[model samples]
Target: MVEIDGMRLVQTRAILNYIAAKHDLYGKNLKERALIDMYVEGTTDLMGTIRVHHKSPPKEKENNLSLIIERATKRYFPVYEKVLKDNGQHFLLGSQLTWADVQLTETILMAEEKEPTILSQFPLLQAFKARICDVPTIKKFLQPGSQRKPPPDEKFVATANRVFNRK
Candidate 1:
């Protein structure tokens, strides 16, 4: 477990990577493992940028969101798609599960649920999100009300609601 800003954050990606390595998910070579690294790094960059933008003030975020999504989809989404296109028997990397697959799937779903139109231009990405949600672990994590909203982020939410037209 890791603590970030007093939040007990677990290193999910590290755990998944360890599991994949132990389970022989990577192809039997260094190059194959490198490919998984590429996928994880790229996806992490995309999601991290999005997370930053999500927590930004609406005024700052409004214009940035489009650019953020555009760049993420153009760069990150296709990488995952190509990975899946080659190794997408079940997950982003392959029939075996990996951290890249889990992270990308969750990021895409959270994006779609919050802003459905962002990835509409990429059906493959949309399908990737759907496939992710269909996975047993992910499905369980996303079960109805399995997670709660961020306690309304009271101060921020109230300010944002007032800034926007939300009644």
Candidate 2:
């Protein structure tokens, strides 16, 4: 939860929506907003899998990782791929960047840390991840000296920098 000017925001989705609204990342129209919400919820589901995997026993980590990768590949990535293909855009919701795009990027980063090859099968998803990371503000924020919660692996950082065209 976060408190700003005496107002408190709780719940992951609620906080994300609030931030998106404040930053004008929620999309323009009602339909677009609904699409964004859909994708955000999808990402949240992927995050749930990640959380379970994180808390699982070491012996079970491999199985959990396999499950995560399978779900990401068979379930999540294809849906996003179709959305991108149908929209003919780099982002999840047409030509505009939405909070869903941000959430997907985060999901990709986490998945990459756990399974580096998880994105290889989905070219469009890979490109989408790169595009989100390529945004100027996001690129800057992801640079070497910037802080990242939980501190991403050095290899992941290098890969992200390369993908984003950042030094």
Candidate 3:
């Protein structure tokens, strides 16, 4: 849950929509929103696989990593690569930077942790990653002392299990 002006907000979509509306990151039209939602949802799918990877047992870690790389390369990266290639735009929805761009950049970076050259086959995605990382705000967040959360470690899994009573 997130607290804004002392009122509590629950659910990920509510929190994200609040932020997107406040920052004007939702795009300017219905069509743009539809496209942005499509890209964002794709990344959301990748995030679920990544969560399984971090929470997997040590014995299965290597296999989980392989799955992440495979899904990312086969299912996700190609869509973004084609979008960037065909649109020839700075962001997923075109010239303007929307929430989808931020989400894609984040997923790309997380996937690279498993395989540094994950974008090696997708030149347009490589370029997109570079461009997105160079954005002023994003560049700042990438700095060492920033609030960017690191990949989930063993401790994170333990905490989640403890707090949620999961295995």
Candidate 4:
């Protein structure tokens, strides 16, 4: 396995684009391809925002997380909901699994653990998350050691849960 210690565009968005190209997830035409790009970038931005907030200081983590979550809901949730509403009950691109769905699901699941109430505002995104979790490929990838909860960190998770009334 090749080790990656730092950032690489080739290893990030480009890698996803390459996979999409290989699997033909870019859709059947130019317009559809544009939609795919929209979803991919939206998903990437949401995840990147969460990552930044996740690494912030504890005293300010809640504020950072709140900003990130708020921005995501405001900026991208509607787009995702619209895509799912227009396309079908499968992926942002519909029926077939795409890297966009994979990345979006991962980010949502991680965010859910922190702010479980976040997806409640967007029912379609919630369903999208559930479907992604149900996939064998994603389910297996997310199994066991794939995602480690932030070691309790009750101060943050618990407080957020209480404020949001998340189970």
Candidate with best lDDT: 3
Candidate 4 segments whose C-alpha is farther than 4 A from its true place: 1-9, 147-167
Better-scoring candidate (lDDT), 2 or 4: 2
The digit string of per-residue lDDT tens for model 2 on 22-140 reads: 88999898888898888888988998898777655567879998999999999998898899999885788778888889889989888887888999988998898889999998898
Please give the CA lDDT of all the candidate structures.
0.68, 0.84, 0.87, 0.74
Q: Best by TM-score, which number?
A: 3
Record all residue pairs in model 3 with backbone atoms less than 3 Å apart, i.e. clashing. none
C-alpha TM-scores of all predictions: 0.70, 0.84, 0.91, 0.74
Backbone clashes in each candidate structure, one number apiece? 0, 0, 0, 0
Candidate 4's TM-score = 0.74
Q: 1-167 in candidate 4: lDDT tens per residue?
A: 22233534455566667667767766777777787777778877887777766455578888987887788778777778888999886787778776678777877876776687887789888888888898887787777876544534647766776788764
Per-residue lDDT over 1-167 for candidate 3, one digit per residue giving the tens place of the 0 to 100 score = 99986779999877886788679999887888888889999999998898788888889999999999999999899989989877765788768888889999999988887789889999888888889899999999999989998898899888988899887
- Cand. 3 Cα-lDDT: 0.87
> What is the per-residue lDDT of model 1 for residues 1-167, given as tens digits with 9 covering 90 to 100?
75544566468766556667766765467876787787777777777776666666768777767767777678777666666677654676567566567667766765664467877776677777777778787788787788634323548766876799664
Error of 3 at 10 (Å): 1.9
TM-score of model number 1: 0.70
How should the candidates be ordered by TM-score, best one leading? Answer: 3, 2, 4, 1
Candidate 1 regions with alpha-carbon error over 4 angstroms:
2-16, 22-29, 88-90, 147-167
| Candidate 2, residue 129: lDDT | 86
Model 2: CA > 4 A from native = 151-167
